[model samples]
Target chain A: MGFDWAVIHDNLPFLMRGLWNSVQLAAITVVLSFPLGCIVALGRISRRRWLRYPATMLVHALRSNPLILIVFWFFFLVPILTGRPVGDFASVLAAFVVFFSAYFAEIVRSGIQSVRRGQLEAALSTGLTYAQAMRFIVLPQALRSMTPSLATECVIVFQGTTIAYVVGMREFLHTTFLVTERTMRPVELYLFAALVYFVVCLAGSIFARRLEGKAGIPR
Target chain B: MSDPLVSIRNLGLRYGTFRALEDVSADFSRGTCIVICGPSGSGKSSLLRCINRLEEFQDGDVVFDGASLRACRDLPRLRSEIGMVFQHFELYPHLSVLDNVTLAPRIAKGKPRQEAEETARRLLDRVGIGDQAGKFPGELSGGQQQRAAIARALALEPKLMLFDEPTSALDPEMIAEVLRVMRDLARNGMTMLVVTHEMAFAREVADEIVFMDKGRIVERAETARFFSAPTAPRAREFLDRILHRL
Candidate 1:
């Protein structure tokens, strides 16, 4: 009959492990997806139909659907392609990678477009090949301008990691669910999970805003 | 004018229904400074862009050095041999001025970093921005940025250079410094095709003045002769209007 905070105290270590898993998942996704997204951005902006069409379709498709649907789609899709029942973690990760890359691709493509056309013209007239010019000149300016957007995407990625819990991936929110079932104190555990998510995401949002302020200065 | 560097043979271009260049032809000779000047929509810039193949034509070709631009397979090589400076500086803002100049040589020509830096410094000094090499382009003034842009094009060690209204974007005070660098380049026998409104520079340095109007060459003559007695009424009226302001 008494409201007890003891369940959260007793399960701190287990909950921390869950948080650690979330951190690892977000970190891996950020690392894998940003670079992949840059390629997709280039492909989306490319003049060639072969590269542009698929890249544009993927970005639009992933952007329209909810994260959970993507998780389920890949959940079923990965097994069919791999010809084996891959782990739930793998499916969740594939979902996150595919989903977040579309967001990042949009960010990077805008950054690329923001650079003036004359910059590309100057680079081309120098006889540097198109790829070389993008690598040496355009990307350096674009990626710098993209820093704030990239940071915000990263924060979203961290928040979105909670979706992995739907697949029974045992991430932070799922660990709270596990503790509530055992202790029969769902109210305390759910509130604790919410507080944790809010605190962490707020800090990330603050950092991204600071980057945006500084990015305004032409560097 | 006997030895030609770029020969435009019946070059024609159109944008939708509007013809940008109509059977435009000119032979730019080696070691000579040719100034192409006309009003805002005379296809002067289009003719310049065609030589570098930046603007492709539906009919005819640009023959640079010896090869025809339309038939050439190695575009990068051809472009490298011919340098172009835009109206805006278009310097790589992220790179230091030194790096901006050295980039083409180091990456495109495979020059060693040390060798490229040396040449970059020499050219930067020639353009009077020797001490500004370590600075980013955003840190420099408009005149300094344009000079750096000129040096960047020169770093390719190109046989021919194209100036597409290089000083048009500069403040009036800054124009003279850029024109000075260009004059120095001309004096050093760097064959250049200049598109500018600077009649003083044209009179002082141009071997010949090419006047275009409505996508056709209306008049072509020696700079002194063009200035004194332009045969075309359009060319005469253009000179009168532009010179009246000065």
Candidate 2:
């Protein structure tokens, strides 16, 4: 019935905690998954069937299944199997890690493959081993070419963290849901949450644009 | 007088079901410049790539110096001894000219950074692109990039150098600069196998001319005799077709 400034003032600390958890989850997921994504990318492109098959299967399976199911599986099944208590945040994080890593692996795989065959041949003929060539020559050039796409993927991934709410992680959306249910102000609280998400995504987009500009990647 | 620096016996290569090279045999002495001229898809590039095992072969073997490449367990070790320059230059786009030349030396040979830098600088200077060592490949002109690529190959101090149409991708005006570098390399007694279309450079710089067609050596002889009085009718015809353009 009314825009309640009082409720907004009252729930500031709770919302801030939720926001911090969201940020922490995103930060940890990105740091852990980026290197893992590169390894998955390499494994997907590996010449050996032993390495490529399982990597490809993992990516495909994760991509096709629902992210919510992944969260449920990690939260409900992981503890039963490991017989150790998994933290709530860790469960949500594991799910996000699996989902985003598959996406990033595709990005890196396509990026690495976009480098021409002649480039590898030239480097090999110049006496560099495959590892040396990939490290210094191929990946650097490929990562350059893939910058714009990679930036866009990063933004998508940052926003995708909203799915962490399904696993009972108190992210931005979950905080909004909790505040609305508690105070009976669904419309106002949800609007504020949407605004927060928009602000984050916008800031991330701006930062990515700056990175592309500095890296000299044309839009 | 001594054993061939690069020797191939009955070399055959197949891609899937298609045969790219068949029963091609040759021996290249050290410090000699050999030109391989052929029509498109006649195995000119394949032949050069085979030397460094860039393109794997199906039959027979490639012997580099005294070692059999086919039998050797480590291909990277053998490749280090054979330097190759490509038609497209294929310089790494993200690296400066200096880094492009020094990467293999530092990584593959485990050379110290100072030594690698020194060797890279000397090679850059030798190839006439010392001033552009800090420039990325996309920032340089086509001719300058190709020269940098050559310097990259030379930084390894290879026993043999291979050129696959080094000048073919350059602009007409730029071709002479790359050819000049090639001629200089030949004059320095760096054993080379060049697959090129520039007949003038071939006639002037090549110690021997090898004419290939249908995946086999049609004819090979001293540059003068091959260009002036060819042995095979195919060589004469190929020469007649390209030479009259000048």
Candidate 3:
């Protein structure tokens, strides 16, 4: 296998475009999942059995399933059931959104639960409603504690965008594969793809560490 | 001529298989401090929590300023009127001291932000840590945190305040500052029921002191009389053990 700087240079713009699409998907998915995760967390922790049982079951089922299976189910199942063709990007995004949302919900639920019960009681005894206490007190603290886990989830979902290639939605890995097919240097192309994922995950880990420091996570 | 500000009758609280408090009954008149003292696991904290419905007692009645806590719909209003402080200064760590004190007032009492902030400022000053308003709970000393916890409780202007071993989490030096704040509240005629092992604070500030053992009130008397001459042997032994530690 030969190192072909020219081939790599030629594909850089297309790869960047694909990378941007992946990043956009991950970013929007993060924003979307956060509130959804919070709601799911609240539901799981609710006093009413009606709310808690179904929410817990949904989260448990999602968590137990593989990300690929989740993507396949949403992508294939939604179109079959609805009789409407959702766009490729939308299907991929929706699949990952649902997958990461359950993961993030577990993060949120544990974070909030890890906080002492006395804190919630204190908030309530002050006359705040359950929603008010959660909004003003519990969620803020839980978000702080859950930051590292949430960031890790973002990175996981970012890399999981590689799975979109399986569904034929051209992403970072898919773009690289196309270039490699033309260049015909499989080893070199795979190494370059690895490098891209490494740099992105490394950058995310560093950013998450900075956040942990700022939030005063105890050593 | 009027009902007590807080009343409990036949309260029996069970946590799973264990009964924390059982068949406990008490009445609290307005504007007096009631000190509850007991050995560890004696249902002192559980009793205080039951009054505010922080812990649900399976078979009992908690009437707070004439509202029944047994009814689910009335708990929020009842809880609003009855504030509680915990052993740990359960201040919201993410918020500033000002936000900690003001949040419930704004959210629960529906006070405007400005009014809440102003009230929070006043209460913070009353606790002698007004300068710490913008600081988070983690930044304050344990005593300051506990005092802020009290101020946070005060922000709602509760008709009754319950303290569940508030000073137990504090360092020796820190306990005094929190007790001073409690003393000040008592002086101003705040209606308070405290579960504490701080015998000095209890004796100095409490109008009535109730001693509990094994989920029941063993003795009840005025603070001086109870400390001077506890009628029950359990109360006497408990006081002796406490005095030995102090």
Candidate 4:
């Protein structure tokens, strides 16, 4: 009851396409969410209650809910709100960005706070406005310190992409599941999918750990 | 003859019901150096921070260079004329010494990079770390880093300078190097407020010495008089303990 190499062999191109879609989703999510996360982080760390409270609430709300609920929330809500049918991939991408940003905001806030308080004092005393100091002195330091953590978070987002398969978005895992349906080789297909995820995440974590050392920031 | 450069009046501050500073007041004149020295947890550093608006005081106000600091709408503009050097040498570790010095002037004042870099090099040279300008703060020794910090502050061409325990975080051997730069600044007529334990440097460089205890100025006198004969018993005890430890 073992082998069906032929099913995978025949579907390699299709599977690779799915893998590319997964990567593309992850990449676009990272690029969009990181900067959005930074803005939300600033609000989270802000002195103004107007900014802090809403940002805090958003972070808590998004983080507390499971990603699947978030996926469904946008998947259904977006089309109704826009008065049209938004596709699954776009809907999932929206959910992914929203979900990942909350985590990234936390990372950014921690990174900004990790900078010695005296550094900001020095910048302020130099007559730099808070915005300018944040732009030049504080952020450069914070970005350097938070690089490893940001990379690690991106890996999680990549792994989290598999959940999109539930919505039938045809990502790597979804594509593998399709092949399994055609071949009646559930064990082989699922095992191959797990191996692929393990390999990608393993490489990503290794890269992150090396970055933590080079960044000289003790985790 | 003219008004004092900085006049801090009835300044009061608290930290959640604890009185950190109570009705503290002082006047710093132009072209003079005042060294504030006291025991740890005393109000020396807090008072310095208040002048630059780093710490918000609960009561009273500071008139800096003829304007009331509390009412000053453009704080960045007000701050630009005041320089601060921290004990830890907060030289912006990610930036080179030259970039650290040039950053504020270029960004805040709209000074061109060429102009800012020129001023930075000259100040760094004056601080005696000119050759080390290309290195990051992490790459510099404590002495070199402190000097670079001084250069960074000086680049603003501030009307007043604040040094909060400038040598307190340095190694014993590194202390003299930073103190020497401070000495040079004082002699060259940079209006400064320095909080330090180095009584000898204070004696030589400070026009006046302000001794604080438990958030109040216990005594303010000519540097020579303060060291030889302090009016306040608390100040006398502090000087005795500090000088003996040194």
Q: Which candidate has the top score in DockQ?
A: 4
**Model 3 lDDT per residue over B1-246, tens place:** 167988888989899999888798888899899999888999998888788777768998887787777875856776777778888888887778898888877877788999999989999999999999999888889999999989888887888888989998889999989999999989999999999888889888999999888898879899889989999999999899989988
Which parts of model 1 are misplaced by more than 4 Å? A1-3, A216-219
Please, what are the lDDT tens digits per residue for candidate 4 over residues B39-87? Answer: 8888888899999899989899999999998898999999989999998
Tens-place lDDT per residue, model 2, B66-105, is 9988888888888988888888999887778898899888
lDDT of each: 0.92, 0.86, 0.85, 0.91
Q: Answer with 1 or 2, whichever has the higher DockQ.
A: 1
lDDT of 1 by residue, A1-219 (tens): 678898899999999999999999999999999989999999999999999999999999999999999999999899999999999888899899989999999999999998999899899899988898899989888888889889889889999999999889989999999998889999889999999999998899899999888774233
Candidate 4 local lDDT, residue A170:
89
Q: Write the per-residue lDDT of candidate 4 for residues A19-77, one digit (tens) a residue.
A: 99999999999999999999999999999999999999999999999998999899889
Q: List the residue pairs that clash in candidate 4.
A: none
TM-score of chain B of each: 0.98, 0.98, 0.96, 0.98
lDDT of 3 by residue, A1-219 (tens): 447656667778987888887888888888888788878888999999999998899899998998888888888988987799998788888888777878888999999987778778888888878888787778777788878888888888898888888787878888888878877866776787799899999999898888777765331
Give the better candidate number (2 or 4) by lDDT: 4
Tens digits of lDDT, candidate 2, A60-126: 9999998788888889977887899888887788888877789889988988898888888878887
Error of 2 at A57 (Å): 1.1
Highest TM-score against the true fold, candidate: 4
Q: Give the 10-residue window scoring lowest on summed lDDT in candidate 4 chain B.
A: B88-97
Give the least accurate 10-residue stretch of model 1 chain B, judged by summed lDDT: B1-10
* Candidates ranked, most accurate by TM-score first: 4, 1, 2, 3
Please provide TM-scores, in order, for all candidate models, with all chains considered together.
Answer: 0.96, 0.95, 0.93, 0.97
- Model 4 segments more than 4 A misplaced: A217-219
Error of 1 at A180 (Å): 2.3
Question: Please, what are the lDDT tens digits per residue for candidate 1 over residues B1-246?
Answer: 576899998989999999999998889888899999999999999998888888879998888888989998877888899899999889998899999999999999999999999999999999999999999998999999999999999999999999999999999999999999999999999999999999999999999999999999999999899999999999999999999999
